[model samples]
Target: MPIRQLPDTLINQIAAGEVVERPASVVKELVENALDAGATRVDIDLEEGGARLIRIRDDGAGIAAEELPLAVSRHATSKIASLDDLEGVATLGFRGEALPSIASVSRFALISRRNGAEHGAALEIDGGRLGEVAPKPHPQGTTVEVRDLFFNVPARRKFLKAERTELSHIEEWLRQLALARPDVELRVSHNGKASRRWKGEGDLLSDVRINETLGEEFARNALRVDHSGAGLRLHGWIAQPAYNRASADQQYLYVNGRAVRDRSIAHAVKQAYADVLFHGRQPAYVLFLELDPRRVDVNVHPAKHEVRFRDSRLIHDFVYRTLHDALAETRAGSAVGVADAQPAYDPAQAARPDYNWRVPTRPLGLQVEETRAGYAALYGAPRAELAYGAPAPAGEAYAPPAGLDGPAPHPALPHSDDASLPPLGYAIAQLHGIYVLAETADGLIVIDMHAAHERIGYEKLKHAHDGEGLRTQPLLVPAALAVSEREADVAEREAPTLAALGFDVTRSGPQSLTLRSVPALLAHGDVEALLRDVLADLREHGESRRVAAARDELLATMACHGAVRANRRLTLPEMNALLREMEATERSGQCNHGRPTWARFSLSEIDRWFLRGR
Candidate 1:
């Protein structure tokens, strides 16, 4: 077979596959084009999930009649003058493929007039064939319409999800853009109804505007973050520690003025909040990072949503440190109450509706069925109860031990059920407020009063971890460390395991751990010192074969060193729970570090203390 050049239309369609993945991609391209044209106000309307129609009107410098023909031509752009300009490409739509690529698979129209033109001209293209530019009337700026997206490619069109999903993507895309340019007025309509509208005044502090677009509750809980270092400026708001979501969709990041989803920024934020939050929960934030444009490369991707920094390591460190400092300064006791409990929306300002499109709704129990089915579905088995055919067991559950050292069984000690002696090994004495003092047969036991209860819960988690693996939290910022000589050696050996625990530990120098990731549980822990400590410990102990075993040792070290201190006060149930967990635990004999966790006292000590005659 002889090789031949692919057709122009096919090439354009191929490019469209990269730039226009969905309705939102189309909106992103057009709106960006409008912004590049100096649009201060933009309007977007979608119909039939942007498959039937998408209209974007912008108030900016518009194309003249002569330029109308070239607007839909590939590589025809004013954003770049020569190939050298590619080195520091800044515009969001410089590829100049968006217009032509979009026109390749859909019916496209461009109507525009310069600021002082008598009348605007409109150019139409259907499936890449350009129609004659005809005289048309329009105000300053431009209006671009896309209809029947992927009409010529049935395969692409067929893959489109329900209308609502498509619309949601469009909404999300617009929201990120609006956040990037808070000064720009943006209005969005779906079908024929206005769903969102924002004021155009160049106000920078209109958190309310952002709230209107991104739920009001988010705005209310967001923490204002502002910092500058080494000629760089970072500004944005993050949700309070307690306010987080299950998905990372809530994280919005911007570089300069373009919305981006860079991992460095996400890693930094996670490191900042590592210890205080739990796994699978994401922090909500809208962060803006500003650096010299020359120091960053925005041309890495055609979509312009990811950038390459000149010194990524430095930038990562800066972001991590800044957020960490800000979080530290924030009062731990500060009320987490929402600034505005209820969102303020004008009922009269109704959102436009697309009556022609179906309102997307998933079937009830669809998720439940999928989750419950699991492997059953994979094996082509019908859904059924996991315990099908087994009658429910009938009985009163076993009663908890009535007292510490109760029934000659120590409830909190690991070896209590050794078939030799009770775990707690003592009888409960008089209960005083929150403390539980007990007498054992051998040693006099004095329990933590509180940890007595927490031990049980911690044991369950630890056992689960031993069977599976330790639970990890991604840090909000990477910790920094100038590792000690010994520490450096051990850190190098266990670096990978530490990373799995959610610490972004990178060896900057032979003796340095330029920490980028920290354990999620130590979100706010001092990164530098922690690295030093971990490494030092590893250096003290020889290398172990099993990484999992090493991780357990590290975890034990962390738990012993990080859990609530012994002297701290506790409630009755908390103390009791700790005791119960200790009883159920295999390591209840000692704390994570092999330190005796508790002391036992015998009932005979009471008579001796009371001075009663024997």
Candidate 2:
């Protein structure tokens, strides 16, 4: 087959496929053009998510009558004059494919006056065919209207989402653009009704804009971060460590005034928050990075959503370290206390719970002991002095506090754990031809032989009673616990609970706590350092678990210790034994926690993945 030339209309349509993926794409391109034209005020109106109608009016350098016809032509622009300009392209748009691509799939009209013109000229293009250019409107700026989008391309039209979903996308586009250029007042309307508007300079005013677009609650609970690093400056606001959203849709990022989605930046931000937030929970942030535009590439996508960076590692570390340090500073202040970071306590409705323990009077550190005997001697009922880096045995019959119920020694009850388990039960099920299950009955039962056990061990040490609810090993001398003013407040409120959990604490000063005795569970653990760490976690995560739930959760962690792991292959009897354990355990129906330990698809569902089901 010989290569042949594609028709102009078809060429424009193909370009449209890349540049005009949705109504929001159209808005974005037009808005970028408006801003590029040095528009001070832009008004955008849409109907049917820019399907039926879209009108963008901007007070900018209007198009000349002679240039009006070429405006709808492809590869025509005044943004770049030479190839050298491409290396330092600072404007939002430069490709000049926006107008032609938009006109190809939609009924496009442009009316503009070149400031000194007697009257504005109008040009119309329907399905990529140019109509006659004539004098029409009386305006000193430009106003573009696109209607009946995708009328000539019915297939694209069919792929459009619901009006609301499309409108949401359009709104998001407008928001990012507005944020990028806060000096340019922007007003967006869908179906002739106002949806969002922004009026301000593009500083760290994202909080105000977010409030206007999302809600006031976001504005009130935002954490403002403004810092500069080597060759890069970052300024934005993140929700308090504890405040989070269900989706990452609320996370907005901009590099050098251009909205972008750089995975490295996102990963770095997440790493900075490692262990601070719960799994699957996303934090809300409006982050902006200011750097030399020459160091970044914005030409990766036709939509300009993703960008390539020259030094991604450097940028990532800068963003992560800046936000992380900023958060620490804010947490230390009384204006944003530990209580304010908690989600469970609403300061607007009710008084927040005491979390004074989050304030630290000492530096933080970590140490691990392997043997049960080592742990026992270090933090036993009668605490003993022990040397560091000592090897110890693994197994011991450790007991819970005097009043609490310990694990049962008798055999588990006879029952099918899967059949009796509640919704989301079935902790772990055998995956092979034979079905094996693990569950908990008494307190919490783990199903997996591996994952459950590891998770249980991790959580046990995570929430153990060493200081708070676990037993404590006393230091030869009392350690000083650093306490922030807010942490002091939290400690004062939850002192009784802390005491019940085996912590003997006293307020040493305005910003200090004195430790007398820690819980037996944490006997060897550094009481001074752990309390501060716990205080920080509590501030960010809210109150530690209540007594009842705490006990169950701890038991669940313990159960996870004995569950099967994924890689640990078992014999038929071992699998059968695991099944019996799950059946005997009460919570065995599910994992130690609420996550589904197993999911069973019927024969029909299995057939679907293989394309066998019709």
Candidate 3:
């Protein structure tokens, strides 16, 4: 074989191999083109899962009669004209290969009226052969019709899935587009029957749209997020830990209104949810990342499904920090979707505790001093000072000293209206030796007493440990660990990050490192495992949470062992004290093990349960 120029038809067919994977790929390209043209509404008609026919009509600025031929010409596009335009492309269809490549494998027609033109024009291409452009009757927008997709390439056509499968693919892509552009109306018809329609919505997102797209459950549990920093804006909805999914199918990411899949941002999100989400569960989110076009490269993938960021580390940190702060606010009383109500006082219930006690359970032998020390900051004073305090004599029913009590009962105002009342309301009773029953303004709240106290203790331990900095434990003799040259490079380059994480590492050779000191909190743990995980994380994500994660694990164990145990009797004041501390804690909704600590049973739901609503 000798070097030779490929024919235009063969070249387009080859390009189609990259841009057109199936019916879904074709829809993705043409729909993106419609959106880029400034369409506010798009109508799609598919036959035989878009294998036999695909007609897309959009109310956007249309192509001109003279430019009709160039619209289907390879490497010719109105989207970009220079290197500068390519470098900072804001449009969805800049490659110019979609129309030509799509036209090469199917019967295609392009017709438009240029928004304000007197008459529409049409151009046809069959199997890469073009016909003359001619005047045609149409509306003030563009209409692209493709018939017999992959008709010229029998092999490709044979590879397509069944009718229902292919239609599902097209529907999925349209769903993604709908999420990104809620302001754009989209209607779909299959086999002459209207299947679905997404009405034009307000702004980038809406709670109604989330419910309609993802389901009512997601909408109810969704947490609204809108943050901007360093010329980047990220806004969307994230499901609370209580509503997480087993798979990541519900996670959607859009970059500057273009849907894409970036693993770096995905990993960052996962890391943000690491402290709360249950093991083996995935979080659901619909996040949109908006940054200056110059800061991101969208030409990396053949289909523009992935992007390369200029400052990936910065973006990662920004995303992680934003969501981390948001989740921290997911404390006990700031219920995501629960409505607030005025306190409804019932003096009788406040005095008469619910004695739903269970049989004798194994006690954890928790100490009053330990619990007091861990929660001292929540009230006032240091752990050292609180640790010396003593509990009231045993066998005394629920009565504590003055300092170990909740707010004083007000005589004039409604009991819960007092300024000292926390958001979780006041504890009314203990249930089944394991739960705390509380009276909110609207209804009853059941709390897992042990789980709640464990979280409170764990968070306090973490705060105290972090505030002291990452204290290092120096080894009498340094130890050398061999690793890949790349790991050695990361250890050398990220020395500052490593040091901040309480690591003193020096490169001993091209593929080895000497460890001088380790985090004092984790000195007794696996030093080799910790260093390897940290280096791996830094090398890939430009950051590592292993140090903090390790330290947290130890504190969590301590808190769990020291937390108040089941079957422990408590007075109203003692229980109220726990409630106040929980109300003031961060991430108190879940324990350190990712289990929920409390749940709210609304008044309406209770009414329905008792058949009182009827």
Off by over 4 Å in 3: 338-421
lDDT of 1 by residue, 267-339 (tens): 6677666533445677788888888877888888877778888877567768877876655432211222235
**Given candidate 2, what's the lDDT at residue 49?**
77
Kindly list the per-residue Cα lDDT of model 3 for residues 1-614, writing each as its tens digit.
99999999999999999999998899889988998999999999999999999999999999999999989998888889999999999999899999999999999999998977999999999999999999999998899999999999999999999999999999989989888887999999999999999999666756656766888788767778899999999999888887888898899999998889998899899989988888999999999999999999999999999999999999999999988887876677655641222342222222222222212231112323333443453344453244334444697424434474443331221233443344566667788889988876567788898998899889989899878877999988898999999999999999998989888999999999999999998898999889999999998888788888888888999999988899997665567667666766778888888889989887778999989958
Q: For model 1, where is the 10-residue window of minimal lDDT? A: 347-356
lDDT of each: 0.64, 0.63, 0.82
Residue 430 of model 3 has an lDDT of 87
Q: How do the predictions measure up, each by TM-score?
A: 0.60, 0.56, 0.87
Question: Which digits, one per residue and each the tens of the lDDT, describe model 2 over residues 9-125?
Answer: 999999999999988899889988988888988999999878899999999999998898788888999988887777667888888899999999999999998888889999999
Q: Best candidate per lDDT, number?
A: 3
Clashes by residue pair, model 3? 398-571
Candidate order by lDDT, highest to lowest? 3, 1, 2
How large an RMSD does model 2 have?
Answer: 20.4
Worst 10 residues of 3 by lDDT: 355-364
Residue 241 in candidate 3, Cα distance off native in Å? 1.1
Best by TM-score: 3
Q: Between prediction 2 and prediction 3, which has the larger TM-score?
A: 3
